[model samples]
Target: MEASSEQPQSVSVHLARLVIFSAVVLGLIVGTLEVTLEYKKLRTTLFEHSEQVAKAFEDIAARAAANRDRSLAEEVATGLLEFKSIASVEVSDETGTVLAWKECGQVEAFGSWLPFEIPSAQHTILLELSTPSSGGEAKGYLKVTASSAQATQIWASQLGMVLISVLFGTALLAGTLLFITHLYVSRPMLRLAEAFRRLDVSDPKNSPLPDPEMFRFREFREIAENGVRLMRDIKRNSEVRDLTANELYRSQKRLQDFAEISSDWFWESDRDGGITYISPSFTKTLNKKTGEVYGRTIAQTTAEPVNTPKWHKLGEIQRQRRQFRDFRYDMAIQPGEVKTVSINGRPFYDEDGTFIGYRGTGADVTNERLIAEARNEALQRAEQASRAKSEFLATMSHEFRTPLNAIIGFSSLLSMPELLKAGVDRVTEYSTAINDSGQHMLALVNDILDISAIEAGKRVLTLEEVEIDGLLSHSLSQIESQAGAKSISLIVEQNAQVGTMVSDERSVRQILLNLLSNAVKFTPSGGEIRVTVDEIGKDIVFRVADNGIGIPSDRLPTIAEPFSHSAIHPHVAKEGTGLGLSIVRSLAVLLDGGFTIESEVGTGTTVTVRLPKNGSGASGEVQTA
Candidate 1:
């Protein structure tokens, strides 16, 4: 396309030619004018010089002619001829008789400035010589002829210089214009044309239009920018048109496929409710003959001794000349398996509005109906999951912020002058509160990190043989202060026979501490919290029971899920982060263990952890009940 728009002359050539031609014409005009003016001035100078010479020798020539001294008169003429510009000199007596005459070499017919020979008469000047100094009478006439060679040579030299300068300047100007046009205009235009030609039509997105910034000329830049915009618009339009055409084609193809398939079929009936035409695909679906069903009512062809309200309703519509759509019915095709079909129909009318017949389509929609139901169920589940996550984030925010607020508030109070003067006990109390808040925050952070690590498969258990008795002792000791602060009783019981189990000590300790702390927090003052360790078969069992607020039986199923606090115990307001139970469950899995929780609303709650006696089996085997 760009190639076809090429002009015979490029812009640079056109500009250069125009400017050079103008310069030549101007040079010629100026040179001609200068030569003409100089020639006139030369003629006037020659004539004036000739007249002065003739007058100077007037007295001498008159004296010589009066005495008839021909030698003396000839002497003066010869002296005048000494100047090369004087081509001829003639001196005659007062009677007009020629006395002395001299003539030198003839001037050339053609000189530098003049294209043809100049007339010798034009350069010749004749002056009268008044003989006596005081007398006006002429004794002789002096005719002097000055050759124009000197003047012509001078004019030719000047004109040659002027023409040389003009030619040089014109060439320079043309060269400079060509250079600038090629650099800033022509080159960029060619590059842009090439870019447009090479643009990939298959992937318009990847093919970018030429950048206007790449050009030096303002007009070219503007043109490039507008061209790019136009190309982009064309690309977008092309994409949209292609997409629409593709969609249209797909729709048509789908319709054609549907028309050819036996899954969905078309049928027509008369106003009398008798089957007039049944599509071949419809007969194939029923595994029956089209001839068998022709002219028969729908109830007569495939009717069975079963509930078919759709048929009855369709018959009523036919009698009333009304339209019915997507009326579902069950057809017990031969051998007792029912195939549910949904049909749609509209009553047709003639020109005069008389009822003609009914025409519609039907499909075996049993599988489609089942699929739609499954999708609805999946959507409902997704919505529920989304709601659960939202609630979890809200609850977790409160859980995290509570400790942060406490830590900040108490730390600020600890800096008070009054508290400093109040003495050590108050300082210690504030310090303890800060410490507890800090620990709570740390636990929350750890739980989140741990769960994330487990989910990402980065959580590895460093297993070792850990004594059950020592673990129990350490867990109980850590939470004893917490229990004491609440005035809750702590009980520890363990079986000596249940010795040691290979497991991650840190994880087990975390599990124990979390459960014991929960017990301490929830158990009212004076209530008992027991930590019992025993052996059950190949697993070592640890149970932490507290006579605190317990969970209802209905909430047990989802209790182990992260942030399932609200779902677990909707009415009870729990203080601890909901992550504790979830973390414990995850850790139990990581260390090859089983975890369970049994609770009654007002009675108490007991959480049990069972780990494999030896960590020989694969870790991350968690069973919860």
Candidate 2:
């Protein structure tokens, strides 16, 4: 089990409590001893001083009696007032009368025991040695008073001494604590932290701390030493374990990223049919694309503690597929097409051989599936085209054969006299028919060759600077001659500001010829076909507009699609191979230009082309036939 961070806090709490409790107890014990000793010493000194004062008063009284002067006792009491501990004294007469005193001079006292009730060495004595002289028998007594003022002085002195001692002791302890903390805790902790920082994650092996036990304090040294050893051992173990773990993580991530971009979704499911890991490629495959459908399994979000039967399937799947890594399967993909998946499932197990889950990836095989499905469709299209070409060739062969057979038979007949006489008109008609059919067949063969070559990417664009006015005029001239035969007007209205531009010269001429031819053929006798040019910012725009029977709106957009044409235009005119506009669009794109067509039913149609203004070098002009 991992240790708790609060474990150290509990130890520290106990240690701190012990330290604080010890300091308090020691302070109390030392303070009590100091105060007690001081009280005893001061009290003893005070009692001795009090005894000396009592003896001095007694001598003063005797001397005063000998001199036969009671007033002399007041003088002696005054003299004793000079002592520092003396509070005050009273000198009194023998009849309990007041005698002379320093504080209360010549006071009267009869018989009072207040004089001897004073503190001694640790006891209080009430009275002793206090009678006046009457010639061996006492008739009158002399009185004395002793002050307890010594007790006050001793208490003051003792309190002051204790204050000084405690202050000095506290200062010394604070300095010691500061030095110990810095030496043991602060500097050593800093060194240990710095050493730990030098360790790298790549090798978490036994890393020793620098100056691990450098703390001079014994406790700090021991802690530092033990902590370093423990950390080093853990680091060594962690390094060994993380090595394989990191490699596995990186490999899984790379595989997942690769699978995400490919055609098919990769999926892994347990034996009881719960998804474990679904690759992001789940949404798209070679044949079709889908959206996010993450409802794979209950464990998709969290790998749970297995308790139920469904969860137990992890073990079952691992037991079955332990030997095989992957297998293929097909799944239903809706809306676009059914997808084929090459799914590979492998069992992942814990150290104890209990299955954790299954992990695998899949690839969509839709393209492979469609190709397999559409084989006959492709075959039919190829076969039909082949048969059409064969039929065309055979028809032409028969057409040519009849002409040849006729011509041969006729020529042979001419060799005889009657056929020779019948030859001129009949032979001329047959010869013309043969020549026309042969020429038509030749044109078809050439068109077929051109289409084939174009489809096969044999054609290359020959770009050069084309003068807008000159190109339009040449194209219009050819169209005008053809339109004149049909009594239609073909006109060129080129604005001079339409500057030169780089383009495929032959392609441009072909585009213009195709547009103009279509216009003239569609226009009626009174209709006009106009070629115009306009400058449009960085590009030059060219338009061929016709006042002819116009195209319907619906068919206008399809004008540029290959193999598309409207039935409305030029019924008697020759039908195009439908590759013209597609070729035009392709050429326009090749020149980095664009084409657009607009028309309204019963109105004229306008076809426009735009090319950028950066003209090709004049020296690179393409010679177009």
Candidate 3:
């Protein structure tokens, strides 16, 4: 069904109608109120007049009642009825016997002529027939009733005058407003509308608006001037729009060509999210036919559940009909094969602004995903390395300072005049202390140099046949004093049949020293340390187990890393340089040996080093047990 197109009313007619309606309604309200107030005043005046008449007839009625003369009472009542407002008069004695009764027929006749009856007002007065010396006694009553019909008739006449005046004023006001509006607003607006109607927007440059000076009022003149400026702007915009349209067409063509050749595919879906149209690039990228995807929903084709957070967010965007960019998800191209897909899309709507579906471009971003992952991994490693370096420097500073401070303090003590003069025994003690500090500092520097050389692939290994028992004894002897200091028991389990192995003697000795030193450092008083050696397959395994404060499982992975001691045991005193385990791992690797650590918090730690009997120059991998 077609809608009817009604011709719109002009501004002048609409304004005139509005003015007439408003003025009439306001006038009616005011007129009605005035008439009501005037009626009330008239009613009050009539009532007052009735009361005055009754009072005047009271003395005459009293005298008549005292004398028991009906004629005199009748005369009083008849005189009271003479007033036009008085409808009826009645006289009664103290005994309730009526002396006179009279009523004017004119009031009844007037009320009958009216469509509605008016209620009358009545007044009564007591007649006193007593001397001045005595209190007054009512001898009779005089009553006068005033008909409200007269006041009502007067109100009606006044109401008619008010209504007539209101109509005249309302009409006059409406006509005046209409004339003024037509001359100033309506006529100018009509001219402007006519000018627009005749305007050819295609040739707006030539179809200029009428001059603003033609209007009489300033507001109309300004409006006309604004219209002229608006037309000028329209003309300018029209020319620009034409150029933009041409450029936009070319840009769209270029975009279409790019979309066809690009590896990324374009797709469109219906409101139900079912695939409707997909570009050829989709098949080329995903190795799938477009027909296979057509009936499938986005969730099905994308290989993700709608309940997943990414799809849930995408659903929310679609529900809101909002645009989305770089929406990434995984799609399965084949069994056991998945590709990360990134898409950019916007909700498409019909000309009437009803959402039809979504249209977007997508690409298989598998390679980009892998690259991003690699980049992130590298970044994390860099951060870890940076942190390790910072910790290493801090540990080195403390480690170096401790011995340096000891050497300085002891040397100062040895040089003291009073101490030297005391005895040679005191001087020898200070000298010995200084020598110990120097030895400790030397060991710290050697360890750092060893680690750096091994890392730089510059460490040369001296491979030789070394007795297992002698090597174990030497390593044990180096840490015996440290173990005795803590009262920790040291135990060794050696296989008598395992005689000797060809390996780097210095690297092996350093590894055993570091492992044993760490045990003594961490072990509590009365704790036990065990060293075990066994030949397995082509490799010889050395295990150092300690019943000491152990590493937390989470730190096990990076515990062998340089300077990780501070991170692992943050609450422990900063004693060692935190490079013992790292050095052990590196040396083991350089000798083609595998190093492993197994630990549990509050339990204990076990470190295993397995070296090939015949040393290999190639580096080995570290393993966590």
Candidate 4:
């Protein structure tokens, strides 16, 4: 399966997560230890300071007691109360009489116990005041109570600040580590992966392996270098495989070419005798010029007498899954045409030895059979051609005389001076009739001469750069008057992309004009004519369509022959020389183009001409005589 295109998490992110998590854990442990130790140290220092203050006031208390002054002792105790941790202090005489006492109300006790009844380190301490005399006995004991609430609060605050610092430091450390990893590891790895992913295996010489020397770490750099080495090896193997595949393809092609050359036709059929594949040469031998005969049974393609003894024997052989060699049979393709072919076929089986199809080669033996009867066929063909020529001459004589007689009769009438004397208008009408007859005769003669020249291979072309849009417009304009007389709307649709083409301008223009004229001439009153010019690939296409009296489908094949007129459009008044399409077809061939016509009687007709955009530089012009 293909990998997702989404950018994935890098090694830097994963490492950052692990390192940041470890830093957070370590910070918590260190912060707890430091806060605990700080709480203990603050408690010890507070007690010691309280003891020292009480001792310093001992001498003052003794003097006060000796002087019998209680007020002075109270002042000493009041001075000690200034300390924040000191809750209260008291001075007593040797008789255990309370002489002075001082209390500080600002101190609030949090507690001596923590959660779960654990004893806290915070506590108060009492100290005694002793005389400096020889007895060194205690004159009065100073009472000191340290609440430790303030000290505990300070510790909590310090711990909070320390925790914040640890968090901030961990975040900064994580970011720094991520940046370093990306620079040294993740980025280089990503580049190597991308380069490998983009490597095209189909082209080994042009596609080089990526360089791994960019990595800073030795281990990763080693990995990249090894990857490059492996890729070089793979590329070498791929080149070898490519060479082998190309050689194999050439061998297969040579065998195919040999088979095609050796036999007149090659074919294959399914186990059910349905044709699967037939070569173009095979179809041409069968007199089928276009389309395919695949998926058809032999009985359907063969003549009506398909149950002959020879075919029966072939069927029996196929039923037994046996190979047949040099099996000759006659195939009647069309009336008056019978072909004899010798075929050699073998049943093809799949890997499991199950019958799949039959592959075969066939040679048309009709020519061999003809050689045996060539003398008889020659005599018959000669007689047939003679008869056909006589009939053609008779028909052509009638066709020529009709137009010649019209011209002669009209010219004779125009030659009379009496018609001119009758009126100038009358003379002008007769002159027009003579001119029309002369044009008809000229068109007939031109068609014959053009066909003869084409058969003699005398056509040549004058190539030029042709403006396609202008040519289409000119052709349509020339046929506009004729279409107007028939009340037919003439339209030209030119693609903007088909601005200009290189072709024989005269032949291209004449081809378009002939098609347009035919559309205008045959279409009924109120019919429509459309001409479209466009460029498709390397070719330029011109299609002329008309809602006219269309030709019969069967007569379409013979429409390109000279003097062949369609009998389907009997209602069309003006008779054509029937050479317009013939001349256009010839011109298309000369220019190395294609021509095709599609028509359905009583419906419409569409004529298409496809010519290469680049005109021929050789002899492509059809010289009309």
Candidate 5:
């Protein structure tokens, strides 16, 4: 069987052992001192007794010595030996002759039987014999040797009794002290310890301590009171600590939720600006894992070069430990795909004010960037439209007033009696001038209405099979007189293989007429115009060429837009409503065809129109000029 481990001694047991040991040590010291003092007293008493015996026998011994009386000396020595302290005695004469000797054999034997040895005491006495008249004369010497055997034996008996008494007293005192300490100190302290052991710090109010009054000693009572106060303080501090921890946990959870749910990603970096943490939203925003981004600096993630102004500014801000916001940059998240990112960050420091690094939120702002660009573009378009409207109003005013002025002047002339009676030819000329101005005004109004209808999506097409040659010939014939007025040459090239095509007859004819008219208007006198019609693939292609003051290259992009002429040459813009090409373009689009124009300053222009053979149902491709 395994031996039980040694149990620890309680305070009471330890105190009892200490008291017993102290009492035993003190008893031993007192006993030894008493025994030693008794021994010395016994020796002194024996010496004193020997001196008395010597004095009493002095006269007798001297007389014996002078007379040489052996019986007398023997009597003195034997008498001295009668005393228990005197173990042996000898009487000697002046001549050195021993007169008598006596010794106690029993005393010697007794000393030898004793547990310890005691040395015999020795004394010498002088003997004198003399008359009263004559001074006493020395007669003999008396030698006395005393044995301490009896005294030592007596001392031993007393010592044994004294030690017994001391032992009994020491044991009794130790027992009494042990009881007192256990009751007054040890037991009370043990109770206090047990109370502490059972105490619940978590609920200090309900966990009572041993009452201070339970301890008999003032010091112990005070200790109990202090323990109560300490536990109370501990409970209060613990409650506060728990509350703070709970609040901190909730705050952290809220921040975590915000980071998880937000569209933006949160990031943290070390002091060297290397990425330490990136939230899960980083993957959602950049289409890359957070792990891949870790250990990389912000500059490494950007498409821009590290030495770019944006990075330089960011570096400067970080170096100065400042906050920055709305810092936008481009990041190539994937091959050939760059996203715009905006970040707001601030430098963080530890409690000791050592720079930690940066923490911030970043959002993929590519969509926002695109939207902003589109908004700016729309604003520019609106401004251009407003300017064009003003120009159109100005051009229209001039065009209208010119015709109105002619009509008013001619009508006023007709109203005058001198003009009315002038002649039929004059009247006819005035009337024709008014008619021509009205017709010009009517044509301008028609162009305006047609353009408005097209823009409003109200224009419709009536598709049919059409003769390409007939259409071209009719279109060229309408502009022939205008070309003749300028003495310009009009050339037509028609492919016989381009016999017919299915399309909106009116739109096709109108498209060709507008092209021819624009050519005539732009061509100088004696310049040439060429018209070509051919079938290309599944479409009928029409080309109108002019050797005239061609359109400016810068204005070509918007040349087919209505009222765009003001941006071109002012002289050419004023001569017409600037809706001819616009109408042609709109009609071509409505019929699912394409129109393109190529022009150069002083080098002339070429305008091409592609009409699908199958009309609005067929796809027509537009070639860029």
Candidate 6:
């Protein structure tokens, strides 16, 4: 059908020949019609002219008839023949006998009556009239003939010239019109259509229309514009369809590779609040299959089964779909024989923020949740035990310290000048022993108090604005003595541009102390530790690097687990509690901060802790060696 729809199977020839042929044909038709009309008009006019002449002749004949004189009739007929248009006049009696006529011999049958019919000629007339008679019998007819062979020749010559003139005029008109129409209308239209017919209609990106600048007609320009618009629309539609198909294919491929990924049942809706699409993942999650819920509502599909809080969780989102916000439902699901899922609803959206649909992942968090619950219970029991244990330890430590204080006071008295004279050596031994024992007992009490507070979760943080230089200087001071014991050198560098980090001053000091001590303990004699303070965005970042034994990569994720110790860190002294790093991690979370470590097996480990700067949102950067 399209093969024939285009400009196909056309015969062409020279312009001259085509115009000549068309002109000849048009000329024949127009000329014939014009000649026919002219003939009819002339014939009708000639008939009217002949009738007037006959009436004049009849008036004369009637006067003669009233006079009842044949000589008068002859004279009147002759007088009536004045018009050259009238060829001759004949007067006849009632019996069809010629009464009087002028030049009766010039016409045939002048005295005899023939059937009085109009004559045909280029210019010829036939007419008759009868006088009204008083008697019932009609007196006679006054027959008038208006014809001249010469006049017929004259009219014929005029008609012949008219026919020739019409032929020439019609030929010129037809030829000129055909040429002008071809130039202005037909030729331009043909060019425009021929260009369109050559377009590649199969490909979406194909250019289908010639440039509209080539079109001279406004109509053709408009046509070309419309074609370009249509092409653009088709191209866009094709792209969208292709993208949708590709997305579906990729999603299916991922599904197959993963071999039964966990399913989540979410009541899906679109920006218009209509259920435009749904997923089969729900059926698999619920230990069911497809077919019962493919085209049904959420109420019909879910295990909730009715107008409980679950079904209505998505109702508001459906109503406000135009706003493009997601509906959140923190609900639980129990797939029979499958693991229980603690689900959180998360919906997806387009760049316009229009709700596309809901898709979220679910994990079996049963073990993690149960462990956390047990930890909470254990923590409560430990707090109750710590109060009793701490009280007894404090009582014992105080009781022991009181006697030691008395011994120290009396021993100091012995060191006075008079007592020193009597027993100086004994006083020195008492002073030294008393001082060491009291300090030892106080240390045991403080350790118990610290552990007790940690278990009870009653430890408070004193957040302060510590400038960068002061913070680094103070932390270095606290750890300089520890590092010096191992013959380790400590270096500190601070950035002047680092604004104050809004952190618990004591806690920050403790975290830094723990990291520095670990570095000092692990480093062989003469090893080095470096502490650096810097500004990242609006946060203060602290990094501590040590050329000490590094942790295994496999233990990185679990290093922050409570009471868990990395094998690398155990190479140092083993007497310390394993809760230092865990305490640091928990405190960091409380302040919305983070800690990280990077290590190589034998080279070194670098730890970075990022804390929020004053008045900045809690975020920063840190890197470890």
Cα lDDT tens digits, model 2, 307-348, are 656446644655565634333334545554444555556666
Evaluate residue 184 in candidate 4 and report its C-alpha lDDT on the 0 to 100 scale: 80
What TM-score does candidate 4 reach? 0.41
Give the candidate number with the greatest TM-score: 5
User: Model 6 — which ten-residue stretch has the worst lDDT?
Assistant: 616-625
**Segments of candidate 6 deviating more than 4 angstroms:** 1-88, 91-172, 204-267, 270-286, 290-339, 346-625
Per-residue C-alpha lDDT of model 1 across residues 455-538, encoded as one tens digit per residue: 676776777878778888888888788788888988778887888887777788889988987777668888998888898888
Kindly report which residue stretches of model 2 are placed more than 4 angstroms away from their true locations once superposed: 1-36, 55-69, 79-84, 91-94, 104-137, 148-151, 154-162, 169-246, 253-265, 270-276, 280-293, 296-332, 335-625
Candidate 1 overall lDDT versus native: 0.76
Ranking by TM-score: 5, 3, 4, 1, 2, 6
Better of 1 and 2 by lDDT: 1
Worst 10 residues of 2 by lDDT: 120-129
Cα deviation of 141, candidate 4, in Å: 11
TM per candidate: 0.40, 0.38, 0.53, 0.41, 0.62, 0.35
Better of 2 and 4 by lDDT: 4
lDDT of candidate model 4 versus the reference? 0.75
Clashes of each: 1, 21, 0, 2, 0, 0
Judged by whole-model lDDT over C-alpha atoms, candidate 5 comes out at: 0.82
Candidate 3's C-alpha lDDT?
Answer: 0.81
Clashing pairs in model 3? none
Q: Rate the local accuracy (lDDT) of all candidates.
A: 0.76, 0.59, 0.81, 0.75, 0.82, 0.61
12-96 per-residue lDDT for model 4 (tens digits): 6788888899988988888879888998888787777776766677678777655546889888778878777677877777677
Q: Model 5: how far is 163 from its true place, Å?
A: 3.5
